[model samples]
Target chain A: MKLTILGCHSATPRINTHPTSQVLEIRNHIFLIDCGEGTQVQLRKNKVKFNRIKHIFISHLHGDHCFGLVGLISTFRLLTREADLHIYAPKGLKEVITMQMKLSDSWTNYKLIFHELTSRESELIFEDDKVEVYTIPLDHRIYTNGFLFKEKENERKLLLGNAEEAKINKAYFRKLKQGFDVINEEGELIKNDTVTKAGSAPKSYAFCSDTAYNESIVPIISNVDVLYHESTFLEKLSHLADKTKHATAKQAATIAKKANVKKLVLGHFSTRYDNITEFINEASEVFENVEVAEAGKTFEF
Target chain B: MKLTILGCHSATPRINTHPTSQVLEIRNHIFLIDCGEGTQVQLRKNKVKFNRIKHIFISHLHGDHCFGLVGLISTFRLLTREADLHIYAPKGLKEVITMQMKLSDSWTNYKLIFHELTSRESELIFEDDKVEVYTIPLDHRIYTNGFLFKEKENERKLLLGNAEEAKINKAYFRKLKQGFDVINEEGELIKNDTVTKAGSAPKSYAFCSDTAYNESIVPIISNVDVLYHESTFLEKLSHLADKTKHATAKQAATIAKKANVKKLVLGHFSTRYDNITEFINEASEVFENVEVAEAGKTFEF
Candidate 1:
């Protein structure tokens, strides 16, 4: 899986910094998360094919998070896209986007599907053959949700030489890979483990942002391979973070530590600090494995 | 008068090319026109002070023209702006902005006033002590209007040497500057022309964009000091311009010549063209003084 940070700053977009937006690629699916303003341009700059973005997930209705939805939808129409697009966001976003389209008289030629989220409890939101996505209800001023993407366990890898040595016929090879005992040509039962080995471990990632330091999400995102949490403020301005319903670096690190994530990525900086290295200094004090997110940075796992 | 092109391309913003947005400074007031996506970042890159922009004029409801408005307004609130902001746009825009703010619960601390426009003919929209703004109705796929900014006639310069020779008292200086005959110390009426020349001719600017080749606006923008017109295509693609309700470079120059504008600026070029100099070449064939608008380029009139 690969993740690209298109923007990580908070509040407002600056000349050199952008607001909240990221691209996650897993199992041939590219998901766009929280499309802030100028996100389409950022996508172009990062060399991500616009047509690959089939699903868009928005955390909330704040302008910094979802303001670019209308523009991206409009650009897709201008490019004459025919693929169906799905949006997973809060309930009010569909109304806002529909009103904008009606006023501009710019109806998309393709299908636009909106899966509005209103539930306050964690629930499965997206599922396919290879991956599953669930919503992690977050504590914020407005209705918000973080997404958890998990890859399904793969089939066992079959050893051809071992299966042949066991006198297994070609017709029973499929059953052996499925971790099933099968009868060979000589009417002898063969154990699946003798001819097969376990596949590589699956990967999981969790995205959380615009939320306060709440332990409720720690259980939901426990033991994920990678966790991206919002660190809008440092320890110096922890009070501001509390008042704004945002998380400080220390708070994010605490959540990461409690969740036991393999690696923690800190983002959504407030843009008030001159040096972002301070975030690493503060977060690493609480969590050993921590990294700060920057615009255009990529992480592969 | 100073004009800065924040974005000059059409359709959608790309890695380096932006959509439609510009800043016009006349008489001590800064007006933002056609705020496309990424306009706030463009403003920051151009070093435009945010507080100076008290009024924003939107040309239409197209995404490329007004998508950045909500983000800009939200940023103003985040910055704790205290000045009142006035927006003049089509009637539906107020509803859209209101709904966005309501959903986000980010009400501005400062007053946000909206002037909903639904007129089909030319009309005065804004007026202050030194500047007057009028809307020029245009033909497009949707409801659209261009703006005309006119500087009010300035006070005549008081010629100290000429006034002293005429034996005029300081008490009558204001009246003389107002172009009235003033009584001298010797009780003789001094003619206004002898002591004071006419103030520099009031500068005028007209902004027309996302419009087709329509001559009706010629009368509204006739003889302006500067005219910024949309040229989305060259002569080769003139048919596309007509079909899309846009204008070609030649067509823009034709209107500029017919209206006797002193300077014509062609902008909103289509991304299909690699060289923008072709716009200047095509427009200069019909108009003597023509320049193509580039992102971040400034023009002084």
Candidate 2:
């Protein structure tokens, strides 16, 4: 899995810095997260294929988080897209989007699907053979949900030399991969351990942003391979963190350390500070494996 | 009066070209017209005093025309603006804007007033001491209206020597500036024209964009000093213009000539075209005082 940072700044878009937006690629699926203004241009700069973005997820309705959505949809319509597009966002997104289209009399040729979200509890929002995604309830000023993508368990591989000589038939192979004992045509028991080996362990990624230092999320997203949490401030401004409902670098590191995530990625920095070294320095005090999330940077797991 | 083109391209924004937005300063009042994506950055690059913009007029709710509004508003809020903002747009815009603020849980500290348009007839919408703005109905695929800003008649200046010889009283000076017959303190009737000369001729500007080549706007915006019109295509693609409810460069110039406008400016060219010379060449065929609207370029009337 590869994740690309399209934009990570807080507040508003600038000539050099953009607001919150990113792209997560797992297996064959490309998911758009929190599209901000100038996102399409950022996507072009990052070399992301416009047609391949099938699903878009918005964390909240902040102008910085989802303002780019309507423009991107309009561009897709202008490009004559025919594929169905799915948007998973908080409730009221449909009304905001439809109003613009209504006044402009511009309709999309493609199927525009909106999956309005209102749940305050964790639930599966999307699932396929390769990955399963669930919403991570967040504590914020508004209704917000973070998404966690967990790779599903893979099928066991048959030990070719051992299985062929062990008289493992095609019918029994299915049971062997599932670690089940199968009786052959001769009515003899066949042990699964001798014919198949276990598959690779599934890896998961958790995305948390625009939230304060909340430890309640640790249980839901524990043991994630990679955790991307917002660090809008450093330890110096820890007092301001609570008032704004945002986390500092130290707080994010504490969450990553408590959740036992393998790697901690920090982003969504406030544009007040000119340098980013302070964030990594502060996060490294609690979490050993911490990295800064820079624009156009990619992380692989 | 000075008109500045913030952006002039159509469709998606590019690294070199912006989508659509402009700024017009009439007698020190700054007006933002059609805020497309990346407008704030454009404003910053052009060194525009964005805080001076007290009013914004949107033609329709097309994403390219209004996507930047929310972000700009948010930026103003972040900057702690305390002035009230006035927006004139079509109906449904209030819902769209308010929903974003509601979802984000962030509203402007200043008063946000909206004038929602739901009619097909032309009407006066804005007025101040020096200028008055009215809507000019246009034909389009959507409910679009062009704006006409006419400089109001100014107070006549007194000819000092003539006023003294006419025995005009200081109390009647105000009435004399209004072109009224003034009675002096000595009970002598003084013709206003004898003491005061006529003020400067009022200048006018008309903005027509994202519309078909409609002639109905001529009567509403008749005899404007300068007209800025959208020319999405050249004369070669006149058929495509008809199909898309847009005008070619020559067609825009034709409207300017028919309306007896003194000058014409063409913009909103499609990104598919490599050069903008075709629009100028086509528009210059009919209108002698024609200028191509380029980004960061300003025109004075």
Chain B vs. true chain B: TM-score per candidate: 0.97, 0.96
DockQ of each: 0.93, 0.62
Q: Each candidate's iRMS in angstroms?
A: 0.6, 1.2
Q: Which stretches of candidate 1 lie over 4 Å from their true place?
A: none
Best by TM-score: 1
lDDT of each: 0.94, 0.88
User: What are the per-model numbers of colliding residue pairs?
Assistant: 0, 0
Over A184-299, each residue of candidate 1 has an lDDT whose tens digit, in order, gives 88999998999999977899999999899999999999999999999999988989998999999999999999999999999999888879999999999999899999989999
- TM-score of the A chain in candidate 2: the value is 0.94
| Regions of model 2 farther than 4 Å from truth | A155-200, B155-199
lDDT, candidate 2, equals: 0.88
Per-prediction share of native contacts kept = 0.95, 0.78
Q: What is the lDDT of residue B80 in candidate 1?
A: 98
lDDT of 2 by residue, A90-179 (tens): 999988888778867788999999999999998899998899889998887888888999999877878878777776677777777777
* Model 2 TM-score (2 dp): 0.90
**DockQ of candidate 1 relative to the true structure:** 0.93
